[model samples]
Every structure is written in C-alpha cells, then in structure tokens.
Target: MSPAELAARLTDPALRVVDCRASLQSVSAGREAYATGHVPRASFADLLEDLSGPVVPGKTGRHPLPEVDSFVGKLRRWGISRTHQVVVYDDAGGAFASRLWWMLRWLGHDAVAVLDGGFAAWVAEGWPVTDETVSEPAGDFAATPRGELLIEGRELAELAPTARKVLDARAPERFRGEVEPIDPVAGHIPGAVNLPFAGNLRDGRFLPPPELRARLVAALGGTPPEQAVVYCGSGVTACHDVLAFARAGLPLPRLYAGSWSEWITDPARPTERGDAP
Candidate 1:
C-alpha cells in the first residue's frame, strides 16, 4: 500500500501506529512534540531508548544493537505482538522512522511498514491529532531474528568487491571524505557509491515510483538491486534508501547497520579518500 493509504489505516483497531521521532541530540523534543499533538491513539517510541540497546566497548557505531533480551523486552512492553500490523512515522520524512521499520523486519516481523511522508504529510492532509497521551496495554512480542536482513562490518568488508555494490546514503561530502562531524573516522566503507538518503525525497515526500526507479537505476549504473547493499552513519538513515528501493520496485538490499561508525572502529579496515576507489 502507498504511504498515505498506510497512514489512513492508523485509526484502525487492528493496526499499531508508532511515532518514531526523536531528535538525534534531544529525546525530550520528540516527546514534547508528541505531547503537544499526535495521531489519535498513537504511542511514542524513542529511537535511542527503544530502538537501540547499549553501546558495546570498541563498537564504533553511534548506536549499537541492544541486547536481544532487552530489545525483546521493549517490544513486549510496546504491546507489539506477532499478529499486529505495526506502522511507524517520524517528523523527518521516513529518515528516522525507517529505522523502526527495519528493526521490526529484522526481528522477523514483516507486517511493519513506515508511514510514507511521515507526520508532515499526516498534518497536511488535515488528519485528526490529539493532545492526550495514550498507553498501550502490554502484549507478548517474541523476537525471532532474521539473519538475512542484516550485514555486519566484517560481512560488508568481505562482500564489497564480488560484483556486489555497496551504497552509502550519507552526503556526498561525507562519503567522499570532505567533512565529518559525528564519526571519529572521516570516510565511508570502501567500494561504496554515494547516494545520500535525502535523494529519496522530493518536496518532503518520497519521489513517485517511476522517478524513484530512474534515480536508483542511475545510481547503480544499471546494476540490478540484488547486487546492492545500503548503509549510512550508524545504520539509521540507511533505511531511507531501503524504503526508496522498495518503492522503486527494486529488490530489497541488506542493511549494514554498524555502517560507517563501526567500519572506522577497526584500525585494519581499509579507508578511501578523494573519490578514488
């Protein structure tokens, strides 16, 4: 279904709509925004608090996967059962929302989807909003990890040159080693082609299907989707690329969540510079 169609289903009792908006530096702001006004019956989920567990020592990614038990606990607390259809949205298009989408899929819950265009589109459509906070009655949500959906740093490092294309969704400058503010390392994964996550949007909404296909094809140099893997800093923004590719009718790419942050952690992983492979 299209994003708007998915959003229209928000009020449906069978669906669970989650607000996945938390400023990278400020968790309070997202809750404050939600407190002011949020979709009817929607619950809030913090990206850092709910999506990620705890950082491991020597792990370079800005956000590391939470302990599986902790993640499962959070899911159960959210009342996300296996049978429920989960929908997520954020203020920043699907940039952050996609993380929750991906995490659900990784946990083997395929019924989850991101609300395309996010909160902005919802507001623009004159959809009803509520100031009252809603609580989810806790439900059982079992975690069954989907190994195929994820690619770790070593896997990405090993698979980069075998006709498999690695796509970086960070800015062209950051991808090219021009500037970096968050990560200790300055460049991207080796053999990665730059396709910034913002490229997926047009006027705050995702590009229509045909345009999305054209852009993805150009980005891949005609390489088919099956040959590509997508990543961004700490595996967060990369979901935008995943969503874009899916909307473009391309095969889903595995996500490298550790992404640039984890790659740079290991001193032995080779780094690139100056747009030269």
Candidate 2:
C-alpha cells in the first residue's frame, strides 16, 4: 500500500508501523532522526542493535542477520504480532527497510510491506508527523527460520556457477569495480550480474510489479527466479532486490547473507570487474 493508503489506515488496530531510519555511517543516526519527528504511532528499530547480529572479523560480514531467538524477542518488543500489518521505512529509499522486510519473511511472516518511498514520501504527502514516541505492550510473534530462503558464503561457492544466477544489488560502479567505498575489495562475484537496487524505485516509490518482472527477466536471460541468488555489499540492500521480486509476484531469490564483504575475505575466490560478461 502507498503512504496515503497507510495514513488512512493509521488508526487500524492491526496495523503496526516501524521507523527504520538508519545510516551506514553512524550507529545512532536513525534513532536520533526518529526522536525529532516520525509518523504517528511508529516505533523505532535500530539497525545495528535491533536488526543485525554482532560481526566477527574475517568471519561474518557487516550487519549479520540477528539470531532467530533474539530477533523473536525484538519482534515482541516492537509489538509485532503475527497478524499485524507491518510497514517498514527508511530515508535511503527502501535500502534499510527491505532488510527488516526480508528478515521478517525469512522468519515466516508474510504480512509485511515496505512503506513506498519511505518516510520522505509519507511527509511529502503532508501526512502528520510526531516527535512523541510510542510504546505498545509486548506482542506475541514467534520466528521459524526458513532455511531455503538463505544461503551462506560456503554454499554460494558451489552454487554460483550453475544453480544460481547471482545478482549483485550494489550500484553499477561498485559492481564493476570502479569504486569501493565500503568493502575492502572492489568488483563482484565471478558470474554475478549487476542489477542495482535503485532500479527497484522511481520517484522514491517502487516501480510497478510488471516492470520489475520485465527488468529482472531481461537481466537474467530468462533464468527461472528460483535459480536467482541476490547479494549486496553485506547482504542488507540485497533484500531490496528480494523484496522487489516478491512484489513482482516472482519467486523470491535466496539471499547471500555475507555477500561481497564476506566473499572477499578469502582471497582464493575469483572476482570479476567491469560490466558482467
């Protein structure tokens, strides 16, 4: 649903709005922004603490998926019941919001959606904002990990060649090794094709599903969606692509959780630069 639609339903008892306004550069930025002004009845979710697990140097990529049990506790604190309609949003397009969206789906919750165009869109529509924080009673939300929806660095080594059409969600420059701002190394996984996450949006909102489907099909050379494996720098924005696939009514692709950051940790793995061959 659009921000307008959500604003209309803001009073619905089953609707739960989460503010995910985070920045990769600063750990406390999101909450700080939320404190100043946010959508009414919205609770803040911190990416570093709430959404991601601890990182182990050379072992786990940045922003590792939170442990299942711990994440369940977070859901309860956020008042996210199984039946509630979840709407996640971030200022940087849906980049951060999609991570939470994908995580919820990985835990078997399908009633979630990203706030189209994010908080900016909501405010742009002249929707009301509040500096007042909300705290709801804890909810009952359990997580059951869906193993098939996730892939680790070890598994990707074998599957990257044939079974998976690894799609890199970083900007084309990052995918092509022209720039490496965040990760240690440049370039992308060999055989991985560039399909930047920005393509999923226009004027800050997601593109129509049919258009998304057409673009993915063109990029994958008609490869079945099940064979698709999506990744970004550290597996966060890759969820944007996964979300796009689902929004397009296509089969959701497996997430390479560790992605390029993890992929480069081991120098033995091959890397490809320039436009994908």
**Candidate 2's TM-score:** 0.97
Best by lDDT: 2
Q: What number of clashing residue pairs does each candidate have, in the order they appear?
A: 1, 0
lDDT of 2 at 35: 95
lDDT of candidate 2 over 125-223, digit per residue (tens): 899999998887789998878898998888888663866689999999999999999988999998888999999999888999999989888878878
Off by over 4 Å in 2: none
Candidate 1 positional error at 173, Å: 1.4
Q: Residue 258 in model 2: shift from native, Å?
A: 0.9
| Root-mean-square deviation of Cα positions for candidate 2 versus the true structure, in angstroms | 1.0
Q: What is the lDDT of residue 232 in candidate 1?
A: 88
